[model samples]
Target: MLDLWDGQLRDIGYESMGENGISGRRYFQKGRDNRTYHVHVFQVGSPHIERHLAFRDYLRTHPIEAREYGDFKQKLAQEFPYDIGSYIQGKESLVKDIEQRALEWYRDNSKLRRTTQEE
Candidate 1:
């Protein structure tokens, strides 16, 4: 059986998981409704995972940002509750815009240390 943790599944076999055996990498999966969902879980020091966690932390620390994110998500869900199959299909430009905005926000607000700093 698949086990869910944060944004990653675990304890599944290689075939069920992937060739890499879940060395803390991001992935995607389809639910019972056949809707695609992104999965993310990374080791403590993993750059990608750290960035994601840092963004989450920043949001948590900044209630206004978190509220804004929640409001946007709620509006999106309300507008496309049943459009999962096509929600991201032809919205590459929109996706890019959102990504750029998120990155800029994180860069400006996150307190995560530089990845290259000496430990």
Candidate 2:
């Protein structure tokens, strides 16, 4: 899989696995010293896939939370310019909290949809 896109992207981690339910390959597009894009690829049955989707959907539906998250990111970027590790570390706790909330919300919504469809 990485081979297919190897020419276009810099393979940061062909087998870059994350411990926080985020195991997959990672790729990024870098031009000069800036990274323009980042991508993660997971298998079909990976739980991280659902977790990520849930987090994304939850953020989309929750404007205030999303805005807070965006603001935090912007602030972190400014505070840790050129220090990606610290930037990510600063948001680690918030991201974990959001992910927990998102997973719960996602499960509840799924249950509701299933019940509605059965009725």
Candidate 3:
């Protein structure tokens, strides 16, 4: 997986480190020290995969919440211009709340779809 990203990939977390629970491999791509992308890679059957997909799908269906999240991040970026730790710490609570909601919404929608198909 690391080979696939090569040259530009900066691996932050590795499964080899045994960091516990779905932490997987996290890679960041930067240009001139400015981060451009963050990618999370996980093996099959990792529960984190579902959680991430669920949150993403939920955000896709909920435009208002997505916009709010984006705005909040932007605000945090301005507030912590040189402090990545502070920026991430500030968003933790809101991200957790949204992740919970997204999981519930995702599961509920999945059930609905299965039920409708069964009928």
Candidate 4:
């Protein structure tokens, strides 16, 4: 998704790149008002987008799980306040568990959707 912050969109100095033996998706990064913004645009219907949305959808329907995940992440960030890699690594197990649940949820919902359409 395209992300814009503060000011008008005009002064974002937007720059984007794709393919050319360099990328599968469009990506952009720019500095405006002393802030740098980076946004990645995934292809529609791509698995990457599906995976992302699936977790979000699962969490949306499960507030307790979402809150636990958020708290875990906050604790990780505190421990690795300046270490991005460590922060990501710390959440690997939780992410995997959540992803499995999300996949199951997607499958169940898709089946229900098809059944409704048939009816």
lDDT of 3 by residue, 12-106 (tens): 42222232233564444444335544456666677788898898999999999999998999999899989988988999999999999999999
Question: Pairing residues by index, what is the TM-score of model 2?
Answer: 0.76
lDDT of 1 by residue, 1-119 (tens): 12345233433211123412445564445453333454554545766664555556666676876786667655666677788545444444544555555667677653345543534
lDDT of 4: 0.72
Shift of residue 83 alpha carbon in model 3, Å = 0.9
Q: Residue 25 in model 4: shift from native, Å?
A: 4.5
Could you give the candidate ranking by lDDT, starting with the highest? 2, 3, 4, 1
lDDT of 2 by residue, 1-119 (tens): 53455544444532322332344544343443344444566656766778888999999999999999999998998999899789889999999999999999999999999999999
TM-score for all models, in order of appearance = 0.45, 0.76, 0.75, 0.69
lDDT: worst 10-residue window of model 3:
13-22
In order, the Cα lDDT scores of the candidates are 0.52, 0.74, 0.74, 0.72
Better of 1 and 2 by TM-score: 2
Q: RMSDs, each prediction?
A: 7.4, 4.3, 4.8, 6.0
